[model samples]
Target: MKRLWLIAAICTGAVLLAFAQTQQGSPTPQTFLLRYKGKPGDVSRYKSWFVMRMVGTMPTPAGLREGKMEYQSEATYLHKIISVAEDGTLEIETVKESGKARMGDGERMRDLPDRPYKRVVKMTNRGKVIESREFEDGEEEQESEEEVAEFPIASRRYQPTYWLDKLYETAVHNIAFPEQAIKVGDSWQEKVSEQMTPNCKVPITINSRFKELVKLDGKLCAVIQSEIDAPIDGQDNVGEWTVAVKGRFNALMTIYFDPELGDEVQAIDEARLVLEITLSGPNRPTLTITHRLISRGKTAKLD
Candidate 1:
């Protein structure tokens, strides 16, 4: 729908404007060390909302046609510090508290069946996942669009290393910072490779910058910006359909981190992507899909 595109456009513009305003020419000489230093038994409750709109054009038997799909959800999670290693690494266990989702077509949101999905992650103080494990406590719910949206962060059971970003890295501006003091205007880069499937490996570089300091809820928060522009295209053959796809995933992420508390206060992520697929053996039909997602999360700590 045109409305979805308009909303995406507006959000994209807002991201650019907000980042531009934080570009102070040459920040001061002072610096701060940012780390994840939660003690064992520390708990954090995070509440967030995810909205995604998909618009596409597909070739049907009749002719070329347009298609649209959208998903929106509100979810909650509880992250508890399981253990802290002597080397500053940590084991954190995250549990899905509740989730509610509905179709984007004016459908009212409803609760996802009451269930608890759990994940335990091991990472250094810089928020890089060294290991991740996901498990559910009960029987799997029937798969559906709403179910997929319910656990957008990590898979229910098996999880690849790259998928671990949804739990930690994205909340911290996608950076695995060096053990060094960082100042405003300082930037870092991390090269990452993600395995989408058994045969598909996508590689990307994440760019992060300490933009500036800001005040939120009367707390001085450090603003960090992250960006990802990666191309993920491949060819596949399934049953009698040969598919060739091309796409780029572009995302803009902003993090509001509390330096004194050594934790995050809020995070925002906006991603827009377009993919073109050509299917052979079926009159060489082509499809073009555009996807836009906006996510916002806030955190509260409980000891």
Candidate 2:
């Protein structure tokens, strides 16, 4: 349960910078109302890959030396919006293309044969995630002891699908535009929630500014800078294990939105998180799995 919680928290931690102004000529003194614009059934494809590394000490027993473990994951995802609402909310669906995860690397890497995992997200134009549902075929993923042990950290079914987690994080943690338009240097704030548990919700603070206008892939894009912070601390009973976690999570993101197309054409983002954990249960002994997670990725629109 400790490891499971840590994985979930890491996804939340990505619960997603500051680029100081450069001598590049100031952006036109024009305010842009950045929002997604598309008619119902209008489709768009997004492809992105991110690498996450966890390095730190794991929890130790009462009299034992502090044990430590670290691992790396690399994954690619394919997503497309299938529908849109009049209010700007949209429904998205995606699946993992391929990748190595948890301790599954080197010659041990096993690509999911069927790629039977999928996720559907309903998100508001302001970038809030209204609902996210996951689907996977268990029979298609039956594996051996060695295979199951390698993916012990991320999910209940022992499937190393961190990309789905990344997709979930992207859907839930994102920009919420301000009501009014603004020019470069204009700043605003937003508040969202992270579901630590059914009854416990943690508020996440997001500060955004219209950093500048830049050109990418030959299209003019609004370069918005943002700072995301979440102080997550809590405990809960998850099945047979008793779990507790506390940590500070933060990220810096620079998004390039295509105003004319009303869609995000590209984005560069990174995040860091440090957490302390404690756990106890029948077979699962108390564990720490202290970790610092670093994530780097890029997302771009394809038509």
Candidate 3:
């Protein structure tokens, strides 16, 4: 009986030791909560580049006219944290540095200057833009209605102030992050609305998923995948013509974000748009436009 008790005691001790080891080896699941952590006076800079290609066929009284358009642009964005409230709301001033765009067939429309622009914006820690200003440019002259009416659609879209506003709007809308703590494989949705023109409003829906946590460039980062769908609605006056767009817009984006740094390290986005544009004015006809756009960017601390 004594020998049996000794063996039983040994077995119990072995089991307890094994259980303790298992408990020590097992790791707790990791939870990530994303929030901006910039303090007053902190600054960051990002280099962004994009290429867009558009092809369209329009029916004219003569026949079908087909055209291809392409443009590429690069710009630098600088963000300065002006203040941080106790509730984690941030007031930031953003500046767009000098930029250049190349457009038209064979890039003949080259060396187009992008005027520097600035804006002050307030945002929450969860990446919600509370308020934003109309960007100001040094070279922007107040155009009369007559002058605006004579501008082409392309010129209106590529105007320095207009481009800057669009970029800022895109950045604000792209911050579709999960509010609560999330683990890998968690998903969320964010809704974004934008004014494509004075009278046209577009609603965009974003589906975001946390794909994985991995090390990128020696820094731990979270890899996120997002899908975007937007539909255009309403009618707007573009230059000399009244235009309406009907179509589906879709995009796929991947972002590598560093939680500790409170910034995106790198990102890639691709989109395809099929649009039916109805134009009415002097001698315009309905047209179909298809566009493909790709953009990439990287961010770093301004030291």
lDDT of 3 by residue, 161-271 (tens): 232235334533455556677778999887777776677667778888989988988877788787877775567675667766566566676777766555666666665
Check candidate 2 and list the clashing pairs. 17-252, 17-253, 59-288, 59-289
Candidate 2 lDDT over residue span 189-209, tens digit each: 877766643333456778889
How well does candidate 1 score on lDDT at residue 136?
68
Tens-digit per-residue lDDT, 1-303, candidate 1: 111111111110001111222248854466666666667887777665666655656556796676555566655677778898988787877776776665644355334444456677777776666776767666545544344334322233112112223322432323566567777899988877665533445567788888999998877788888787666666655445554556666667777766656567676677655555554555643543333333333333322
Candidate 2 off by > 4 Å? 1-28, 59-81, 95-114, 139-174, 197-201, 236-242, 280-287
| Cα RMSD for candidates in order | 9.3, 8.4, 15.8
Predicted structure 1, TM vs. truth: 0.72
Candidate 1 residues lying further than 4 Å off, grouped into runs, are 1-28, 107-114, 137-174, 282-303
Question: What TM-score, computed on C-alpha atoms, does each candidate reach?
Answer: 0.72, 0.66, 0.71
Residue 117, model 1, lDDT? 64
Model 3 collision count: 0
Compute the lDDT for candidate 2.
0.54
Error of 2 at 257 (Å): 1.5
Counting only residues 3 or more apart in sequence or on different chains, how many pairs clash (N, Cα, C under 3 Å) in candidate 1?
A: 0
TM-score: which is higher, 2 or 3? 3
Question: What's the alpha carbon RMSD for model 2?
Answer: 8.4
